[model samples]
Target chain A: MKNIRMKVARTEMDLSQEELAKQVGVSRQTIGLIELGKYNPSLNLCIAICKTLSKTLDDLFWED
Target chain B: MKSFFQRNKVKDERITNLQNKIYREIFLIVAAICVLSLIIKQLNHGYSEANIWTEAVILLVSSFYYMIRSTGLGIFSAEVELHNQASKRSMAFKNIVFGLLFGIGIGTFFGIRSAVLYADSTLQSIYYFLLVSLVSFIIYIPFLIVVVGITYLAAKKRSDRAVEKELEDDQDQDEHK
Candidate 1:
């Protein structure tokens, strides 16, 4: 499933996918893929994304 | 100094993963092509040392490079750890089976080459093939098993130490926090 939570968190932080990806030290395409659920980010990458968006892992990645 | 390729490279996990996958696929394809070409040459011209040396060198050099790099990086140990967790069969047993298959392949290749070169008749060819194959198998099997086993054990030891160190470092950080 698409990571709607992460997308929302990024947007709430006033970040585009490119901006979030740059902050996380990944490519814009990778950020897009992650949001689309086409690629699973490694834990380190997930942590970095969470930090960039000011979100906890549970807030951005955990499924209810 | 960074090379042109390195200078322009993107520092992305997905890109790294894609590059690794591409490298593996290309290596396999190249190796397969080389093997097929060698077989075709052998069929048409019979076994000649000249026909095989280039392909053998290419395959051996690439394999050795990959093995050395992976071993140095503890990838082999990580793979063994993953394998142990995911599979019922032990890595050592898998290694032994691999060694056996490799030994048989090499033995057969040498046997066929020698038979083609030195045997005078059909009966003599068959005799030489079996004799050489058995000898080669006997020589390679034990050597491969021992060498591979030692390498696996040493890599595992290194990986275990690295993991322990990481755990200790994490604990130290937790205490500081």
Candidate 2:
């Protein structure tokens, strides 16, 4: 789980890491790590993030 | 946030001080029990009959001291601390209750087996009591260690979860504007 995809998503949505963290129910540090590909969110947290972004888990979280 | 951190630090320090005091008191009581037992043994010239009354007195005193000492530590005042302590108390209580139940069940089964399979005698009855008491205390040691370990881990995990949840909730509420 690298941050490349999270960074891409954030850039596409024009949302800051802090803004995304609020929408998805996580700490800003958590969002930073997600963008930096450091911390892996739990399944529930991943779903919450996907829902907040109007995306699918596979679309936002799945790795190539 | 700064005051919250400071308050938690103060709570940690106060709890630590109280815990140390409790430990010191327990240690002193144990030492006193050992000393009293030694004095009794020496005064009896090392060749006296078993003094059941004296032993019972010692047991009662020690048990009462332990109970009072534990109670005096007082309840955790902070909500977070209370939650952590409650989980610990419940886990420890469960471990003690379950361990004692299991030990008694096993001891009774063995005692019954020995009595039925062999000669049923007064000596055997005494032997059964001794064996069961020794085995039960030994069995309790591992359970005590495990219960303490699990309680510590659970409290730490819960506290971490609470802080994380608080941070998350604060952010969520901020965003609702």
Q: Name the best candidate (by lDDT).
A: 1
What lDDT score goes with residue B174 in model 2?
24
* TM-score of candidate 1 relative to the true fold: 0.55
Off by over 4 Å in 1: A1-56, A59-64, B1-16, B108-130, B154-168, B172-177
- Docking tier of model 2: it is incorrect
Scored against the true structure, residue A48 in model 2 reaches a CA lDDT of 82
Query: What's each prediction's TM-score?
Result: 0.55, 0.28
Cα error, residue A15 of model 2, in Å, equals 1.1
Over B26-84, each residue of candidate 1 has an lDDT whose tens digit, in order, gives 99999998899899998999879998998999898998787666665545555665566
Chain B, per-candidate TM-score: 0.64, 0.30
> What is the docking quality class of candidate 1?
incorrect
Quantify all predictions' global Cα lDDT against the true fold.
0.75, 0.59
Q: List runs of model 2 lying over 4 Å from the truth.
A: B1-177
lDDT of model 1 at position B21? 100
Which is the leading candidate under DockQ?
A: 1
N/CA/C clash count, model 1: 0
